[model samples]
Target: MHLRQFNKAGVEAFRRFLEACRENPKEPVPVDLLESHEHTVLTSKQIVVEPREFSSRRQAADYFQDLLSPIPPDAVRKDAGIWTWLSLFYFDQICPTGNGNRKVRNDYTYIYMPDESRYFYRHLLFIAWQVKQVAPECNRLFLDSSLVTLDKLTTEVFKRLYLTRIPCLFELLDRLYWDCSNNRPAKGIVSPHKISAGDLVHRFPTRIRQLEKTYDLQSLDADQLLEILGDEFRQRAATSQSQMELSMQ
Candidate 1:
């Protein structure tokens, strides 16, 4: 998905979007054209182009701050509504903002170009995951509808499963579904089923590293991969429990 420039026209459009949302909170936004950006943009530009050009860092920061200021107070009222709006309308606007601040280059960059993938801005996906905590039902709906949009915008592993031919991937989605249903904590080391989909996606690379020398996943079949993932999940659960126990000592 293309990053929305926090330019004059984009900012005004967002304001109107928020007004529309406040007026009809439950009614879904007309997102068909907006949502279709996934296939179109990813295919056209396989890289995150630097969308905003600033003459100086100060100008960019001021522009970003403008975008941040108009966040509707009522947007946060429905929990996931605000974040959904953010993900949909504003996430890309300030993605390349400075130091997580509006400034240009601070010591850190909040958003950057996608390296090997066609997506960028991972923190937004984490925010999407956070939506599950306060608004599970809302989060579910949002995830169901917007996951493709998110996948189009970021290099997310969960998105990879959407196109995966592996049968175990469906099992993984099933486990995540049940985890959300059960209201398990999304943070910390835990069973794969109990972890948030976004958290699991974030941690999977590391977990894969933990198993790299132990299993040649590339050589395994779908069922074998499923078993291996289960083994690792249980090991992580046990490790989490041990750490929790030690913390009490």
Candidate 2:
């Protein structure tokens, strides 16, 4: 299998690791250290959660900010502005860094921006995965040019499916957007909103949930999920195209 992102599965797996950390708050979270050269082969225990997973969002945010602090400075002089921005955004969202009013959670006075907090959490998870999967090269590349590397890696992963004639995630997502757009007819013309990557990413949560309901996605693996998604995307695309043609007539 090609390099798979630690997206959903990685998120879940990291949560499991966190759950393990939460079990014992007093103890220093155990990490099985690997030699500097052996970073590519990953295990669940690489990250050592210190003190404990905090109860409050503020505490959690602070802890995470400290944990991820090393990464941003590395990316500072490099072209990894997104990496730095995302990191700063998480901590900054906890408290408004500027003159603008900050929104706080209803339950907690200082607690604000759960969404950014979660985004940062996912980033940490990605880092944890990279530490194991990419090895020493991860530190060098992830800070400066990880997105480009990841995009290339994603393309490489898709290329593998070409032998089996399978549509990759990018193709599936494109078809999904095309299939979902409402066609408007006015003055003998049709118009469809231009779907972008952001649009697709925004719609994905709802669409993926819908797909889960349609199939037993919980039981399926990544490859199986891709297969089902591709089939459904193609079907939707075909149906939409037919509908558009009929509407024109």
Candidate 3:
């Protein structure tokens, strides 16, 4: 969708609905009714990049953060035909924006940064999970599970698995069936490998205080890191915005 004018209106309408939903969780959400009237706020991805004389790359990244905060959902709804509008590779980190706003006809969301792995936004992955719970009929689901056991995987891995059938996030999860070995090295096919050449498909909770000695990731807080990164991003956006103004002048 060209960020159609109607979509911009729709985005505002969705934001209003989000606010209302938070205010009244018990209220009946007439999704069909609200969506019918909502116009898409953005008409398209023709959003001009108004860059400023950014003193540093950090300033440029900050601008993107500011730009992302105001997007409408129609640009990213399952029904609408939009994808992340701009590149995520602005600086050291992969600052996320339209990562969540892009829409696919099937309602399955795929966000991969072909440039770098750090630019991958996990929250967009989370959104698909959330939509599954709230609107399973609206979308089918898949996820790439390769990240479950690795400290790091390259951007190629994220891309290779993103559109493949085996990439569905839940495809590989299974119960441990112990059998056939007296003293085992955890032998036998624990599970069939996901992510075959055929197809590409593919959270943690907050608040669980996992034991410090636990081998798996128990708990973590990315607040400080997020804040510091957020600050850098703001500067970037400001610079970009300034540059846009200057060009216009």
Candidate 4:
């Protein structure tokens, strides 16, 4: 179907629908509300969006990036209506019905809150799309999980403004966490105590902050950053690389 954006009335209607869904999670989404032309207008840049299941957030991001390429970046970013509409379009994936119920979270998780900077990053689709646009290289580390999961690693990395903007930081994260053989993040990286003393969840960002104070991190690439990291990270990187080599043999 052609891409569309909700009008102000449409957004309000969507909000009301969400409230109802929260009250009765088993209630099916109204097809009429989703398809009503009066509630939504065609997008300025016409693009077809078919109903499809995405294996991972990475795939979904890539799909959206390609589909929305015709529209200006700023236009896409600022348009809350379009994103909210997309959320409704893929409601089943985001809030799957299982065992006669759907576990819907806070409204912000599905609806794009453009005016509220604090909640802006909470929208699942918007955040996935934004992260892919900003840090394409870290997709394996960040977006490899199923569309519904908002993993700790992704939350930790993206919440930090400095981390998101730096190309070197993305490279460092990829080297440290991404499992090349499996094409997924290294196991236990996200758990605070699961990996080791200094895990990605608890220590990586703090360590980077400390390093930033003492060094011009922007000037350093991933290799240099690796050398500067504590033994915990270096050892893990070494172990991962060794395993990768062994797997290839």
Candidate 5:
């Protein structure tokens, strides 16, 4: 009866309402919907999504430029600029933006410098979730300075809790890099090649290459994470629809 989001069940419920409107034509709106002002909440909140866009590597290099702000972009150091850049974009893309009907996706793109051969599409859900929790105000601060309003102090306190509990998951990323580097074994004894740890590129693939799909892999790759999320959303929608149909019957 909540009908919070418009899945198949919510749709069916809406159809029933419309049918009632046709059949009775004079009855007051359903209490479950008219009980509050939340009926149109989604419409007011939905951000319009634009067409997806791609970008070149040189452009990516500029956006990922090292931040000179109070917090360093490369928190783990060793100049993981690409990883840092990807994390932000990736977090923003992990889910469809809207809660109902066509959750808008972010239009984002980036590329590697010089080579420009590989283009990476990123979705940084964990990072976004962390920021949403720890420093949400900071997350939306946007460096404008003028936008820092004190209206969200309570939310900010929770944001602080989020970061403390998660630590932004940097250590976990470090271990992932270590694993990716060791997996190849450097084609046997990679020393004497003047390769530093910084030279190693940590490549997470588009799928769950080896690990089983579980909470254990909260930060493996964007695509797999999105897949898990998509499945969950689908299952929840199906359940809701089933419940709504059951109730009407």
Candidate 6:
């Protein structure tokens, strides 16, 4: 289908639609919204989206990046309307029907709120697309996560405004948390128990920020970053490597 964006009225209508969905979580996507010219405006650059089941966020990001490549980055990067429309287009995958009903969340989760609000980055599709564009290498971190549920690792990392810009931080995370053997994140990276004391969700963000105050973190590579981490992180990294080695054997 050709790509279209919701106008102001369209966004308002979409919000109401979400509200209705919350009222009746099992309600199917309103097909009319897809074709309603009154609510949506055709973009100057028409791109087609062939919807399919995205196995992971990486696949979804890559699909969006390839499909939207022809359009100027600025046009789509900050375009709340297009992102919202895309979210609606892939509503099933992002917020799929489970058991008997869908679990719809806040409007910001489905709609792009570019107001620099804390929830601005929460939009499922847009954040995937954004991360793919800005930090393609870091895609490994989310390679196995569900497209529908936002995990703690994602929430904690992206919520920090500066974390995404520093490539080394992602590299460190990939080394410490990603399980290359199974092609998923290492287990318990976000666990809150004593076993996961230096976990990604709780310790990494604060430790990285502290590192920023003491070092020019932007200048450091992943190895250099690892060198400075506390013993907990290094121990975890060694364990991760050992696991990868064992899996390969």
lDDT of 2 at 197: 29
TM-score order, best first, reads 6, 4, 1, 2, 3, 5
- Ten contiguous residues minimizing lDDT sum, candidate 2: 183-192
lDDT of 5 at 22: 43
Preferred candidate (lDDT higher): 1 or 2: 1
Q: How many clashes would you count in candidate 2?
A: 2
* Model 3 agreement with the true structure over 76-104: per-residue lDDT tens digits: 33322122222111111222124333211
Ranking according to lDDT, highest score first = 6, 4, 1, 2, 5, 3
Model 1 Cα lDDT, one tens digit per residue, 134-217: 233313322433321333212334345232333343334333322342243234323444454334554555555555578765
User: In candidate 6, which residue ranges exceed 4 Å CA deviation?
Assistant: 180-183, 192-195
Model 5 poorest 10 in a row by lDDT: 142-151
Query: How well does candidate 2 score on lDDT at residue 84?
Result: 26
The local distance difference test score of each candidate is 0.37, 0.33, 0.28, 0.81, 0.29, 0.81
Q: List the residue pairs that clash in candidate 2.
A: 40-132, 40-135
Q: Each model's TM-score, in the order given?
A: 0.28, 0.23, 0.22, 0.89, 0.18, 0.90
| Candidate 4 wrong stretches, greater than 4 Å | 35-38, 179-183, 192-195
Root-mean-square deviation (CA) per prediction = 16.4, 17.0, 21.1, 2.3, 23.4, 2.2
On residues 1-249, what C-alpha lDDT tens digit does candidate 4 reach at each position? 788888888888888888998899877786566568878988854698989788888888998998899998888888988999999999998888889888888888888987786777778998888888887774677777778867777777776777776668777777777776776787777785664545777778788889889988878888888898889889878777877787789
Q: Between which residue pairs do clashes occur in model 6?
A: none
Residue 19 error for model 4, in Å? 1.6
For residues 21-92, what per-residue lDDT tens digits would candidate 2 score against the true structure?
A: 345433222222111122122212433434343333334434544554444433322212222223222323
What's the C-alpha lDDT at position 59 in model 3?
Answer: 40
> How well does model 1 score by local distance difference test?
0.37
Ten consecutive residues with minimal summed lDDT in candidate 4?
A: 192-201
